[model samples]
Target: MKTELRVAAYAVCVRDGEILLARWVDREGRKRWTLPGGGMDHGEEPVATVVREVEEETGYVTEPTVLLGIDSIRRNWLRRLAGPGDWQGLRILYEARIVGGTLRNETGGSTDLAAWHPLDSVTSLDRVELVDIGVQLWRDRPPLGRSRLTDPANG
Candidate 1:
């Protein structure tokens, strides 16, 4: 009966015709593609968290050119057979430009590889939905504020 809220950041690292991404083998040993960022630490700014996370995950220094948008996911744990609203996460997406460093993976990190994937091929890859959102945000810079949507039932 406890709600767990997690605040995280995601970096859309783009260059040339490719996008930098972090790939990992999950606990089940399945490979997945994810953005180069993670949860924000205490007292850390979202921008700083994104920058640090990108470096840690991809070994590349980056500058946040623009904060694309925020993505929030809320799940009712009770309905999920766990607890009441016990799982939720908020992710802040930022458009990043790689300024330095080489492509490498962070040892002992969640991701085991870092590589650039073609933008056009991204959709074909098995990636999280947030990855598509980040690409859309990069292509279309939405309003400079919280962009939220409510389901019809919620409305």
Candidate 2:
């Protein structure tokens, strides 16, 4: 068994009545919409990573105004190299706004297309969990710190 931890930063950009989203196509050719950000490089700040990733994936320069929250997911998978393993994903979600640049599809990147979808129509699209989480964060800016939930079974 092996353990893998990945830390990523995501941007939630909303303008007018639409939200910016990037389309991600999986290895099996399935497409799902996600935020315009990805994993942070070693020694890179979360803010900088979101800025670079947004520009790369959506062709727009953005400024992160607030850190909405952190979303973490842990799962088990079978990898060819590591065999059965556990992986945890910690996503730093931020509320950002476009500062400049024109809208264009990403090239040779994780996302092939970038588009703005009406907030009302988002529920109909095939999107990842991040989309919902991002929207919630955008709607309600939580406290500026970590949140802990108690488990009843522990009591």
Candidate 3:
């Protein structure tokens, strides 16, 4: 199988016990709440990527404070255009604070809505694994190196 790697950045902004999240709507019309971020542009710094992506998805101007950790995931899938392949995603997570802007839904973007969810309520929301990994890294603040995520299904 062919292999492809995607490098992305995500922001975790928490204020007043609430976490900012964006609603990711897939091609199949499935929706999941996720951190406000996405893949980086060529040559863009991860920090800059997260800042831009968060603003694009959540309508919030944020300043990243700390590099939380990295989360990686590998999965096998059959794509219509790429055919059968192994896809690996490397996500850089960062802790950020809102500097300006108001909460609003994205227009004609990957995410349709953005909102602040209670940290305690996030556990019950439909979300991607990256969301959990990002939050864990933020809360745990692992030192030394990036935190790696293992594929539970494969393990």
- Among these predictions, the greatest lDDT belongs to 3
**Cα lDDT of model 3 by residue, 24-142, tens digit:** 99999999999999999999999999989998998899999998887787889998987899999888889999999988999999999999999999999999887888787778787
Clashing pairs in 2: none
List the candidate 3 regions with Cα displacement exceeding 4 Å. Answer: 145-155
Please give the CA lDDT of all the candidate structures: 0.84, 0.88, 0.89
Off by over 4 Å in 1: 77-85, 144-155
Over 1-155, each residue of candidate 1 has an lDDT whose tens digit, in order, gives 77888999999988898998898668788878888999999999999999999999998999998888887887766645654666788989998898998888889988888999999999898876677778877887768524433223335
lDDT at 34, model 3:
95
TM-score of 3: 0.91
State the TM-score for model 1: 0.85
Candidate 2 lDDT by residue in tens digits, 33-80: 999999999999999999999999999999999888898888999978
lDDT for model 1, please.
0.84
Listed in order, each prediction's TM-score against the native is 0.85, 0.91, 0.91
